[model samples]
Target chain A: MEEKLSVNHLLGIKNINQNDIKLIFKTADNFKTVINRSIKRVPSLRDITVANIFFENSTRTRVSFELAEKRLSADIVNFSSTSSSVSKGETLIDTVNNILAMKVDMVVMRHPAPGAAVFLAKNTNTQVINAGDGTHEHPTQALLDAYSIKEKLGDVKGKKIAIIGDILHSRVAISNILCLKKLGAEVMVCGPATLIPKYIGSMGVKIEYNLQNALKWCDVANMLRIQLERQDIKYFPSLREYTMQYGINLQTLQNLEKEIVIMHPGPINRGVEITSDVADHNQSIILNQVENGVAIRMAVLYLLAMKKTENVKN
Target chain B: MKKRILLDSNHTKIMLRRIAMQISETHGNLDNCAIIGMQPRGIKLAKKLLELLTEITKNKKIEYGELDSTFYRDDFRKGDKFLIPNSLNIDFLIENKIIILVDDVLYTGRSVRSALNSLGDFGRPLKIELVTLVDRKFNRELPIQPDYVGEEVDSRAKDIVEVIWAEENSSPEVWIITDK
Candidate 1:
């Protein structure tokens, strides 16, 4: 039988074949080689247009995607609610159709509404790449994080990865859990009692309220950024209480194995989810995650584009 | 089992020379052009083409590189695990250079996909044209067509077309062997 690339369109890392995984890694390797060179840009996707439609506020992800698109020689159009017709109370489908009418080849979108990218993909002929959509998923971030982890610690299979912080609200945590689990890693979601979801254990992942116990069992510790903006919902009583009970600090680091790698989906809260020292440590793959983000996005874009072309030809 | 000659070594060399001339004519000159051979038999063909081109144009600056597509292959699951070889020797930058991607045969076009993937690792070229020694019409999975073709042959799925160079097989001939 012909081997099919098993990528989950929604969850992001579902059933991705080993060959396709190797392809992504290999592509990322190529991008890494060109990064330090004089001409960083490649004319691989010359004349191809990519639109970034961000319904949510973001600085890093939006900019990184734009840079990645530029590096691949793709034309980019950045659309946000602040400047676009979205401010004039335009329907998502109408706005998307208008953008699609311009003959853009792909859309890398981030929406406050969950599964917006999936919905757009179902409706539009253009390729829909999920950048981030509410608390549902941020697949590229998860992919980059996985790439970083794989680069640092080799294959993630059989490795213990503890995802810490607010699991209930973190899109990063959801994505990480799905990605890590798919890659055959033992995933553990650990945070405070109120912050951790009740049914999270049903996802075939181990759940722990105590960070100390989770730290002991894990080879990699991924700290999800505590969304301070969502604090009004009262998931936890106080920031101090959350930090003292569930935060990854120096004391927590000292208690754990030295070989354990540190990770964070950034715009870090500094002392809330993870300590400043741990974040700056040698074992931390936070910065590498940022670098890998571009490559992973490139791989996603390339694969999706290739699939589209194949469909059109067929 | 039966074996039949497809194209001899001398015929192969003559075809490559013709291809080189055709390529030279198409690109105006061999001034800013380079030839990259996909490894193993393709490297031998590339070397022969390089010599033929050099004799034709007397331009020693025409670059030549070897490309190993083992690492970049799309169907790694189907490939032999122990057959992977060392990487290619491509010293010069491929940027803005018209690259002629040379291979032994065009069968499934999957190898060409891998070759493209591998080529991207080095540098982006101005234009890429594929040149293959044999064009076997069977089953093509990818949408890739060779710019230069040596010989076109129709074959069944059970038959394997073998191109034996003088360097490897001593008796230089292209043969199709069908095993049942």
Candidate 2:
């Protein structure tokens, strides 16, 4: 099989087809083995350097990408919005170009503005990976989520996935829907009426406002983080009200007809989006998702680096 | 294109069986020996050898695994062609065990080098041995040799040696193709 990935940079899941996703998952499979080994490091990208350029606050994605870079034996330079010259009113392109002048091979970026990665990709010669661009897309997160689903359920095709909560501002939800749908899985969005986008149903996803129906219908329920930081106006009544109607608790999970996998894109709102009991349930693969994030990011970096080197050879 | 049969199905089976016997002779009872097939083509050969060894010795205690050397290769991202990685499915620890690395062809010895690096990531082996079905003599870029070879074939740079297996083809045949 030819390893030529369809895209140079994973800007969004929207541009990738089933083959590309499968290829990433396949590459992730090898990386998953690498991480589980005793040495847990490969010199595949020994000379290559990666930059984790985060213009927004992050814990898992930043740390995961750094760890992936380290595990691949790639040189890493981390840039954060607070510490970088962007705090001194330096523009995005100027900052990235300045970093590129230092010989960075790729940039894994998360910015607060939507299309931030796309903008940087257009402006820079270095490869741009969209870690999270506002609520636009976090392609790696989506890939890891899909990979985790495939891991837990043995496959993703023909499986029912309900992405619950904060659909309006959840990049994880958007990316997961596209990824799951691309992999032949049925995806439905479940959130409050105000929180769910009006035309999200047009994207071939069934919209369910009720939590019980969503949980009952899905083989996996991915509860997205409610973006309190991104919200300018109140989208829901209160945390208590949202938790009462939409939160995934032990009682709600026990009431379901069959067992379903629980997922969260983390820094969970605890009692708000999911209760502690259900989050700690053996069925919840939140930590597995985080662990797979490292492998998935490694796969992404490794494949993109291969393409870059192949292009250089050409 | 002119094709010459280096080994037919019968010859291939005999060679594999002889190699299995040779392995059993070296490490009797085969308890601590782990057979790792370098992936894609090597895996098929390793699986066949493991089956034969198990049947001949009636010892099903030998550990067998497949190791993909794509990520461990030095030419991984340096080539014009995109490199697709194969499966690495080793479940047991290779620590302090006699490791037999199996591959179908030994041309440049780079693949075996990568396999050694990959095996290092797993665990330290007590002793490592190389087993190749077709040992292309005089084509090595590195100082690596197979401990067990099925057939030592001398071929030019333009010649292509291929192992046609029933797993991927209609019949098993080793063909040497030359442009005439």
Candidate 3:
């Protein structure tokens, strides 16, 4: 049973197959058990070194990747563009190549430009894990989200998952849609017309305008954070009006006859994307998503490290 | 390529009864003792041993656990094949209890070494005893040996000694194959 992932680099959720997703989930299951133990570190990647290269500002994603690397017992090097030679106009390839000079085995990268991780994978020989690239795809986030869904609901198949709030500027939304769809879940993207992407319909997901209607029809609702930093022009007239139209609150959940699982990729915009009460609701799996993030990232790194044995195979 | 029967099902059952009696004689009533099966293949041997142990000592029973040592193995990235892990189901505590670590074959002594390392996670055991269906002699890479063995065979390191214990294809038997 040589159950390995199809792709070498975790560029995005779009680049991996269904079996790759399943393999990742299966590996994550073991790591999940390890993390809950008295001693939470594994010696699987003891000889490997991973560098986290972030060309953008982040809190949760950066910390999650770092913690995942640490838990695997892998030596890690963290680089943020604001503090590195990147601020002095050093190219991505040159910066990464310099780190590679130090014998780094793998890279977990988040860049402001889309396809930056893809370009890095092409130029470098080491395995590249896309932490996040622009608003393209956060594959690990999507993976952890699906894993959490499976953990909560027993399975991801035949589940109706509604992705609410800003869809156009979320890598998490794209990755989640691709992952959930691959796992045989029904996905529906909901938001204001301006905040939603025009190309979303091509992804084979249902589009809905009414928040209450979408909520009533789905088994899970994943609320996305509005990327105000990436927004140049006004997508909506006012935050207050957008909250009134798209935000999920305790009332929205209570009005439904069936309870729905609530999820958020963190650094949540409290009253804007989801109210405090709903975010902390009993049915909310927001915290479980955070813990699963480490396990999922560990699985990705460990599987990719398994590829290194193949490097010496020939 | 070749095949040989070291022990048939009838002999295997009788050998299991003898080993179960030995275990009962060593630790009478099985108090403060537990049975642990190394995962992937040792689980089958462990299950059979537990059934026989229960039959012989009807009043005493031991908790059974499946331990996977893939993560603790010294050869993580050093091997040609990737280590695929099996599920660990050691729910009961092994603290201060005797653990009879069971496996199908004892070769290289590496798996047993890693298994000993893995047993540390589920609390410290008072002692650990090794049990095996076959022990490949004169091919040891580490200073380790099984306490209880059904049979010991001497063969070339390059040759293969396979134990086909039914279910998948043939009946319960062991084979030693050499390249032509």
* Number of the top lDDT candidate: 2
Off by over 4 Å in 1: A1-11, A14-22, B1-180
Q: Give the alpha carbon lDDT tens digit for every residue of A232-282 in model 1.
A: 688878889888988887777877656789998889988887889989988
Candidate 3 docking quality: incorrect, acceptable, medium or high: medium
TM-score to native of every candidate shown: 0.72, 0.96, 0.97
> Which CAPRI tier for candidate 2?
medium
Clashes of 1: 1
Q: Rank the candidates by TM-score, best first.
A: 3, 2, 1
Model 3 over residues A6-37: C-alpha lDDT tens digits?
A: 77899999999898898889888888888888
Deviation (Å) of A167 in candidate 3: 0.3
Clashing pairs in 2: none
Candidate number of the best TM-score: 3
The lowest-lDDT stretch of 10 consecutive residues in candidate 3 chain B is: B166-175
Q: For candidate 2, lDDT tens digit of each residue in A1-314?
A: 44678888899999888988888899999898889877899988998999899889999999999999999899999989898788799998899999999999999999989999989888889898999999899899999999999999999999999999999999988899999999999999999999999889888999999999888899999998888988899998898999999998899999888999999999998999999999999999999999999999998998899889866865
- Count of backbone clashes, every candidate in sequence: 1, 0, 0
Error (Å) of candidate 3 at residue A48 is 0.5
> lDDT by residue for model 1 over B22-117, one digit each (tens)?
988887558889999988768777887788788888888889998776545554323223222334567789988999998887888978897887
